[model samples]
Target chain A: MAYPLPVANVRLKNLTKQFDGVTAVDGVDLDVADREFMILLGPSGCGKSTLLRMIAGLEDPTEGEVYIGETMVNDVLPKDRDVAMVFQSYALYPHKTVQANIEFPLKVRKVDKVERAKSALAAAESLGLGEYMSRKPGALSGGQRQRVALARAIVRKPAVFCMDEPLSNLDAKLRGETRAELIALHQRLESTFIYVTHDQVEAMTMGNRIAVMSRGKIEQVGTPQDVYDRPASVFIAQFVGTPPMNILPAGSIETGKHLVGVRPEHVHISPEGSLAMTVTLVEQLGHELLVTGRVGERRVVVRQPAHSVVPEIGAEVRIVADAADLHRFDPVTELRIDI
Target chain B: MAIDQIRGGRKIGRYVLLVVMAAIVLFPIYVMVIGALKPGNKVLVNPLLPSNVTFSTITRAWRSGHLARALVNSSIVALVVTTAQVITSVMAAYAFVFLKFPGRTVVFVLFLATLLVPLEATLTVNRRTMQSLGWLNSYKGLTVPFLATAFGIFMIRQVFLTIPKEMREAASMDGLGHIGFLREVAVPLSRPTIGALALFAFLTSWNQYLWPVLITTNSDYNTVQTGIAALQRASLSQPNLVIAGTVIIALPIFVVLISFQRQLVRGLTAGAVKG
Candidate 1:
């Protein structure tokens, strides 16, 4: 059977970056298929953003090569890279009107008046910045400014789009709306997107393939399901989930398995399975209950489904999960178990 | 009532201070006008007002000093210098701020260091240079040395630093090289500072007296300041025309100042804070 061709496969081979006396991105290799929404998720000071900037050609890697499609763009200037970036700052020119800011790139490229307007209009409409065209960025609301920023990036019609925490500057509700819109927008455009964020929830929701990076090194790269269900390392397990994965010591239960990873949503109250524990505290989130307690010497969190009776603070409860669903890891190496 | 009285006392105190400062600042100008308006004989009397001022005294000063031609010459010089200074400074500032060329920072620092050297110090050397080029008394000689002022470049560079790097990056991403990006992106966004700098440049050029007097021996190319000074000598016989010429010279600059007061204040504040 013939398989559909990937849109643009990006391959980075042994990528390394250094600044001043310090190394930032260290020996990372990755391949992202065309139309893939790949997220580099990490904590602050992690080199994930630096790696994205290298991909955007804003920074040059000290060693190795980066391939976008089949082109090795190691020394290529940022402008000719045919990629656009949205900054965490939103980086909107404060003085220019929304229309002018969005039209800026097109204008520089000498994209004629009619075509520039049409592209800007199309981008603005989709991003919901249509009515505020003539208003300066300083006058617009944060959400509107963000939309204008997004429109400015999209109007370029680039082959690749790199966003460094584009939703981070927004409030919670607007971030959610913009996130959903971004996903939809990505689907409609069918362009390759490399999103860098520290927020795992954003990584989980938006990325098809998630690369968990820690301290300038990529811990794991996999499909969201693969990474979430079978995290390559303890870092990936803990980094890819909301409220994070609960990594508790299994302690000789399984050989080479010093820790077993459990998602909060997957760990349940069964009263008979796994081990018995007394709930020290409970948090009700309308849709779920977060039961925190001690299982052996390990602190475990179990998510009870909504509408379930809330367990008392001191009540004894049993945290349950299938051994098959458990992701086991070595505490020393923090690498995933094959079993 | 006591609180109201205290507030009223402070308000009155502030008004008194302001009025005193204004009078102190404007008194010299008032003196010059009175001196220019009185006949040479009445000048010794030096009355504060123009009560007994004669039109004939003013007319004799106009004829004797040839102030009309000097006024025209001054306007042209100021206009030319202002345009040249603004354009050159903007280009130099843009290059320093945005482009990466060999020796750029060194060049910029050298340019900025010139701000410490007084404009008068350069007058002798510039006049020699002008004479060598056979440009003495020409408009080119009048305006050339004043171009590319350090103040204009420094002020523009201040505003340029505040602009988003992303805009510059975005512009570059669209195949806009240095000059292209400056014109297409940076310049348009910097309009307010440009207007502010333009006013500053105009003021500097229009008020310049020493260089114009030193360089241009021919009376045809004399600027407002030099022309007015020469007018003072002729109007020793008649003060009215001299006062009128002083008013004429001061009017344009005063109007320019009043209309752009906010911009001027911002420019001054921007300069002080930036340094």
Candidate 2:
């Protein structure tokens, strides 16, 4: 049966959360479109998870409102909000088999036994967990356990699915595999997915729109390419890249009263270049080479193609980045400056 | 081969030590049984032997000591106390661990402070209170005083705390309210600890002697412990009869301990998380 699952639009109106005088989620406003895959990306302690929890009604906002699907859910209980959550630890009942775990939400809603069994079996089969229907969560591996958690959330056909680092416990290879599977599931079900993760790669790959947060506030919200190509602030530029963007002091660049940022891939090792550096280390991966060097007082890295000539560790090199590729930020405010 | 012989010798030594310890622990029970089986005239003679195994003294003890009524009274009181204690303990423990309220710590500490006051220290006052309430020689007097215990609260609270915070949050999101979560998740997860607490309350109430003697003057409300004491006083010349009463009182405890051994172990190690 092709279920017409209800999709929800989520809105946060200046939501704030404080724990013992420390603001975990400060006056943050966001809107998630119906059936959209929205990712909240940040480092640990940046309040992304707290923001999602507030939407789920697991945490009460200290100073604002949360609306889910046109209804203000601030005072509503989590279950009444018609939202499902996939926790970081999976949080599967240790005593329950996979089938029972999937059927738990349905059972709580007082669904009949035959209907519960049918829905649980369908969810499990879709997650490819049919063989593990009789196994306890402890008996399953981390990846399989996470699938059971996913099946449990979907069995009730919730409007919004809030996931808190659901793939963090898996190894790298499995995380990549699960990431694709989640995208496929989201597309098929067409339900709103609000995912939180500290890993920028996961955010860039999976989120239709990524909201980068830091210290209880949203730094920027945009499409993945928008965030990568034109970061709103130095923090976004530095936080969202692998071997993060090279930040140089204002004194080193001609950009007045502003710091210069260039991605590792944007910085080139050319004979006719502006910046001079001494190569210190070379990380040769199969597809790319990460070249680390010192540019005057600052440390810089360049991502070169694997076919490029490897530079000696102590060699002096000149690096250049196109003006279009450079991001200038006000040194004092740390906000981006359009030159 | 030499190493194997030494390992075998060590195993034998371990068995020998275990046998010695078991004998030491069981010696008193063995003596009580031997004494109970002997005729009153033969009780003091060769008390350790199995000779003259007459059960007339046991029958007399059961009849004259009013042990049958005493057993019924003790069972009712202990069962009531155990069930009430489990319910109160689980509810109180859940509130302490999960629910947030003002003065929570102060209230918890005050509750814990009750544990420091020995039950013996309050027995007299409790007996007097029961007398004033006109509940003396009644089941209410025996059971109400022990319907809840601070130790039970502390134990079940610790077990509840071991359940991760995420589980509670997940349950809430899964449409399970506080009472639903308690019934479906919290209580089931803590079955072992609850079982242990129930057994503890039952055993303590069953073995109560001082309070029963203080509040229960009528032999109809006499529990097993106090009934055994009365049997001792009445049969000073017939020691075998007292022995027979003691044996009967101790049998139920052994049966309970053996039957609930697994739950007892689990409850004792309640906070140890299993994968």
Candidate 3:
């Protein structure tokens, strides 16, 4: 690898956090490019939040190093880290009005009233919270409260914005709305943003790059398409999609050299195919049809485009995927086999 | 709406239960007010309401018994005690919850373990410790021993625990020192619980009778609570005057109770929930 001229926003080298005797975050390395929207995507206990907190300097790394720009911030207190975080619960200062909450960082840095309000107003307006700047978090809707939280984080024009499931508290529709707002906000600010969520949909939609974490280590780090199209391992392939990527013990050990993977969209009714399967259940989503069934003892799922003539649940249909679409993994290692 | 629609004998039973509970709650308080207002001879009647409830006995009690002075002393002491106690508890709670240091958990466990070893059982050694400090008969004597209160620390610490680690991180990223973050973010987010704790501390300090009586011997140095008990002993036979002073002594607390009534309930429930 050659050096890129762009300075990395935050670089983690083997960052780790251990609690008591348990390793909560194992050796993990990551680079968040300047102005990039990177999501630390993983299930709970995967150490994603721990990584974000370490970057914010809330948690000290038990091992390894964290860099904000060129400085190693191993011992820096969170307040001096020049980062801002928005929590899953919004975690707004409920007693303070939106304006006061946004102005808090400035106040702590001893920025005067006039400048604090001006910057707070800009951040608040950027998040479409201009109309409700005087309201308390308790008085605002969940989405509004989340925006206020985002506003508070960006008001400082910080070098990094760390968000831990900031949209998790909202209702489903509101989650979608606030997520879009977050992306737009990221673009306009152009500061490094590291978001954490267990939801892959959020990771897929928002992150310019996504770091897939599992059990305290990075499973894969790439663009949404990169991780989705070429998952580095079985855990990621299964973890990154809805209805999860189905796994089957291969038809034969030799065939396992070129393993099988079919995206629900690619799993289609084929009049001619090699494998035999029995249909067990059918799911009709408005836009697509999913056929779940068994090939021997192993379960397989096939998803097809909506409004197309799809097979019935009791119908034993032949299905296949293009050779390029079929992913292969070493039978023993489970690491992907590049063609 | 479901409850309203729930009609019949069960509903009647609920109404009766509600009335009984309300009466149970109000009766003792009603009796106390009547006892305070009744003329000395009429006090034995235990009237439901005050008769001849003129302000004279209150005025007489307020002046002759030195109730006014006692009231002032309790106000000042309670105000000082509650502020010191809450601030200390919040700081202690913050340190225990957020900061990591060598022996930190052991120290927190030791502090919490203080609650198990009853303060009543430790009074002898505690009193000796105070005397050695030459703090007897002083506010330090009264307030110092009560600082780092087990309950205050427990309540504030419980509230501090639920504040997600993210807010603290956010505060720090904002370049806030620990104290700054506590004041600006953690404290504000935990305001309802803190509100409740402040009220609880004030009430506990104001209502404290045994500690203040043991520490302050002189009448003028007395807290209203301790002073009222002294006034009773000095004039054992004067029930009406004593009751009058009691009512006066109870007034400020009543005002605080009414004003911060919401927080008292919230504070208590928050503590209960956290525990």
Candidate 4:
């Protein structure tokens, strides 16, 4: 390539999308820095995919604008936006050989054959797909087809990469390896990447900044640690963790709020604790234990290291939470109340 | 041992059934070939057998029927119709599936409603339209009315709908718009259905008897099908010539079906099967 593609930050201003009479994405405002890996984390129908599609120009927004670099691209055609997408289905041109698939973006750009072949080969070699260049997508395994899609995305070196759950189709092991590969690719290219997925593990592991969304609205946006440590809303507090945060009525501890939350790992069992709970179930992981029980009418989970003394089912235990670990929320708004 | 015996007996039964079916289907072809090969005087003597294999009747039928010109005209019409239909169907199908507009559903429904009106029902009106356009007795009369087909639109549309919507979006992000996506992705993936559609368009155009009979007054534009019918009437005294003409008329279809057997089957069963 004669010149490397310029890295561009992405901005969404009051972006909204509606289908029929119902809103799919409602008033989303975001800024993705150049070279930042931003993950849109939400459940299905939370409109993460719809938001990404708006930025890619695949969906027309019902209101507001999208800016790539300094250009307001709400009206720009997707092809002219200089963005590349990797679909979840891999969506490889099933009829084209892998080599041709990687060469397609360049071919569409009217890059000469000699240069197209050279860049395609370079991409294939980087992805360890040199051996499968002549094979059609159907002949390759799921993992290999995904690599071909990545090769195709990178061959042209677009300013932004919009991937819609690109690793969801791969098996658990293959997804892990591909995730590492993507991180390395991001570092090497230094271009903005907008990834959408419902998996929190992917969001926590891969994104420099995570936007947690629910019901067509962004609940909060922050770095992984920030969102995990101090969620802005009760939805983020519950949605981003395995077994999630245990939310209960703020009882008698003088918390001065209607509701309080604590992550499972933050709730611990000790003899001198304030709350008493009856253990109802036990989940034994090799490295830790998750004990589920009730404090009054509200159920909560406590994560304990394997070396710690564990509680048996049908036994009573005292649970404690450090004041620093307690998250207070306004019950009516479900938004965090900074205490 | 008992299981093996049951399996062996079933296999034999299947072979017997297949042979009977094959014989039943091939009987008409056998009669046509044998009748064509027999001499005019001996045609009724041993209709089941090749009594005297001769080329004289076939040659005379070819010349008298003017089948060479008929074959050329039919080929031109079928080829033109098939190519035009495929291109038009693909474009229309793409529009229906990918493009968004007001009244899209109503328009698609109206387009599909044409499929319910049998070709016979529209023949008279279409013929009148062609006549008013000065297309009578010309290749335009034979090919123009058939340049686009509703059945083709329906089949290709069904195939196009199966494509993941994300593929189009992905192509857009890759700097290829709708036209590029249709060329590089949609058409290639739908090759089987398109092949089937082409075979069908060619077959339907080639075998048209009523349309050609109504459209062409000049013998120069007579298709093989009309030429074969003319042979039957002119050779009332020479039955062998008529039989030979019938065989000649059937040869091209047989060649086409044999060469594109896969596509023909796929086309006929296009909506019933997934690619």
- What are the chain B TM-scores of all models? 0.84, 0.95, 0.89, 0.95
lDDT of 1 at B211: 84
- Considering summed lDDT, which 10 consecutive residues are worst modelled in model 2 chain B? B266-275
Tens digit of per-residue lDDT, candidate 3, span A259-321: 555566666667786566788887888987788887777678888777767666667777676
Q: Estimate every model's Cα lDDT from 0 to 1.
A: 0.81, 0.93, 0.80, 0.90
Of 2 and 3, the candidate ahead on lDDT is: 2
Per-candidate interface DockQ score: 0.49, 0.83, 0.60, 0.76
Pairs with steric clashes in candidate 4? none
Candidate with maximal TM-score: 2
Candidate 1 chain B weakest ten by summed lDDT: B266-275
List model 4 lDDT by residue over B98-163, tens digit each.
Answer: 998889889889988988899899899999998999999999999998999988998899999989
For residue B86, model 2's alpha carbon misses the true position, in angstroms, by: 0.6
Candidate 2 vs candidate 4: which has greater lDDT?
2
Off by over 4 Å in 3: A1-8, A242-258, B1-69, B102-143, B188-248, B251-259, B271-275
* Model 2 chain A poorest 10 in a row by lDDT: A249-258
Question: Against the true structure, candidate 4 has what lDDT?
Answer: 0.90
Model 3 lDDT tens row, B98-194:
8978998899888888889876797778777878887778788878777668678878888888877766666667776787878876687677777
Question: Model 4, residue A125: what's the lDDT?
Answer: 88
- Give the worst 10-residue stretch by lDDT in candidate 1 chain A: A1-10
TM-score, model 3, chain B versus true chain B: 0.89
- Those runs of model 2 whose alpha carbons end farther than 4 Å from true positions after fitting are A251-255, B1-12
